[model samples]
Target chain A: MSKEFIKGNEAIAEAAVRAGCRFFAGYPITPQNDIPEYLSKRLFEVGGNFIQGESEVASVNMVFGVAATGIRSMTSSSGPGLALKAEGISNLAGARVPSVVVNVARGGPAIGTILTAQQDYLSATKAPAPGGFKCFVLAPATVQEAADLVYEAFDIADKYRTPVYVLADGMTGNMMEVVELPPMRELSELPSKDDWRVNKLEQDGNFRSISSYSPTAEGLQEMNEASEAMYQQWDKEEQRWEAFMMDDAEYVVTGYGSSGRIAKSAVKELRAQGIKAGLIRPITLVPFPKDAFDQIDYGRIKEIFVAEMSIPAQYADDVRWATKSKLEIISVLTSGGVILETEAIVDAVKERV
Target chain B: MEKSLLIAGFGGQGIMLIGKMLGFAASKAGMNATFYPSYGAEQRGGTANCTVIIGDDEIGSPVSRRLDTLIAMNEPSFVRFVDRMKKGGVVIVNSSLVQSKVEDKDVKAFYIPANDLAQELGSVQVANIIVLGAYIAATGILDAEFAKQVIAEQLGRKPEMLELNMQAFDKGMAAVK
Candidate 1:
């Protein structure tokens, strides 16, 4: 019940440790170094493993190695560093390993500014490695969410038999917040090391393995079938979102991460102007909860808009996919450290009205 | 409803601490709040900033253009956010660092000499709290008692500076009138 003033980055590290993550491996990157730095100090005290890898690639692989043993493991990075771990992420996906990865995203496309941005949206959701996989993405808009979701990330990764991303922007990571550490849930035991962990099975009878290459066609097909089924099942269990002030909403403002905060201010202003503007914030980006948008009564909505910290519009694409183009999707997308301001959103709503 | 406030200033100026304190206070008041700070250029001698949102309803967007009220501890923050403020919004400025005067008929602007006020109390670090005290006093959004309670609870983080902080807040609130 102790409340401690902590940075979002340190909270993530602490929460992961508390959530039963036994291994911490990561490479340092701006707005994210605090994650490894904090974990390196804390993991040892808790009798866990924490390693700062030579590179993002090696760090991710180190995580993959531990996950292979069915022990809760994690690694974190920002955009450019995440790019370096792509192959490793893909390898883990192919092996159906359960692990948590935190992306304290910064402005990107290249070595973009250290300021927060959601530009890595598509790349994160659609794993670009050899085998296609979509992570369970939780885009946290606040420092509290950044702190709290590390535990949730572990739970979801284990439940779905895939990676769970505690996706946050640099703003959320670097921010200082006196986050209430929620009670850690009793973790579900991993499919016992006797049976759950590979190679740990007695060499007498079983040859349990975690590998990108399954020697037999049947083995490869079985792995693909297993992952696909797991993903679909996860979509059902993990689809999460929050709809705000929508009962009388004439318009729905869609956003996630930092942009969601801006949309909130605009909604209040638009409502004060007698416009029924509400917010549809997708907390889970992979499962996306399209039904939430699909279920909205189009006749009640005058328009829909998506706001974010990217130029070409990533979540905008998800919004479009949800509605069948019944409602015209407009985006208040801003690039770099900036995001859509409330004034800009109000103007957009006014034009729509 | 969840309200989000972005407080911008220099790193050592306690910009992040100010945001975090507000979040803790909001939670103490039984309102859900989230404080997010950004480091990098903002902290390394650029313009450090953070956002704190508290509301009765779920907070939708975490980003804001103009705040319901702004506690600008520096000149750049005042320059960057002054135009974005709601016409009748509350703008609490640090008159010590922001030498330039800004006047608007629509907005109620309370210019507190935050740095000077804190220094008078023997520490300049509590300047952000001074500005926060001014925000509470001028806007009347938070009760002075609650602000005091929050200050006391958060004192452990900077135990040495607690007395100066309370005095700084007192001076700041007095300056508002």
Candidate 2:
């Protein structure tokens, strides 16, 4: 329960270390450079390994290598760097290696601005891999939540034997806030690697090989089905979200990450001004928090405003999917690294209702 | 209640440090605070600014459209953020570098010669501290003693610079008085 005022990136790195992550590999990218920079020193102090990989490609592979040893490992990147690691991420998914990847996202189509944007929502939630695989994507709206989710990410990754993602924007990565960090987990307290890891096979007299390739069509089909079943279980159990003042609301403003934070503020102010507005923030973006939308009384709701920092509204599609397009969806969007302003959201709500 | 402060200046003027100090002090005072810095290639010499929010509860957005306070260390920064100040918001300007006048009828403006004051204290690098001192005096947002203690703890590593920074902070407080 030690509390400290720290930057979001540094907080995530520290939380990961406390969660028993022993290996970190990353390259420098804006908004997320602090994660690797902080971990480079913090990891060594904990008797862990830190490598400044030559590139994102090399860094993710390094993570894959470390995860194969049954140690918790992580890699982080921003916009363009995330694109480079996509292949490795897909490979990690196919191999079903338990790893954590953080994307302190910035605006993007290709090499977009370095400012905060939720442009990676679609990439993070829908198509993180090539073979229709999904990631356990967690989007945090505050630095404290970011730290907590990151600390829990390791256990979730290990539990499912899959890659879990902490999808934050630049604002969440760079912002400084007071966070109560979790208790540190010692190296010896980590889960044993005897069952599947490639290490200590000689001692245990049990051999294991890790690979993404399936020899036959049946094998690949079985693998894909197992992955899909895991995703379904995740949707059933791992869905996390926050519903703010939705008991009797006419306008529901929905968002995630920094955008969600702003929209919540707008909703609060709008409520103060006698507007029946509330917020539905999806903390788990991959499972999509469809239940949160399901709980929304569409009969009482007039329109659902999907606020985000991406033009053409990337997360709005998920909102539509979650609600099954039963309610009218209005997108409040901005691109090119510009944050969604509170006034803009307030004005949007005012104009509509 | 939540209070949002924006500190703006040239890259070399310690704009980020001032915002961080306020955020740290707010957290130390048993309040929740958030400090968000804008970083890019422009960090070398171009304009740099950071937004800090302090509240009794969890802060929603780190970025604010209309701020409760704006500390402008240069002319460009003053012109850039003055319009973003909320009605009756406090505007602290470093008169040494910024010559603009605050004309907003609803704004409360304080002009302090932070650079000159820091020079008299024997270093222009402490100009931001001087402005911070005046800010504490003007807005009464943070206790002066608590802020000084934060400065001491932050500069504890560089023991040599501690005395001068304290003097600059005192001078800035005096300037506001």
* TM-score, per-candidate, Cα-based: 0.87, 0.97
Best by lDDT: 2
DockQ of each: 0.46, 0.78
lDDT of the candidates, in the order given:
0.78, 0.89
Worst lDDT run of 10 residues, candidate 1 chain A, spans: A185-194
Clash count for each candidate, listed in order shown: 13, 0
| Candidate 1 lDDT, B1-177, residue by residue in tens | 544567887667888777777776766666566666655554466788877766765564555665677778889988987776767777788889897665777877787888888888887777888888887678665667767788887774666667767887787788898
Q: What docking grade applies to model 2?
A: medium
RMSD for all candidates, in order, please: 3.3, 1.5
Candidate 2 global TM-score: 0.97
True contacts kept of 2: 0.68
Provide the lDDT at B128 for model 2: 95
Chain B, per-candidate TM-score: 0.89, 0.96
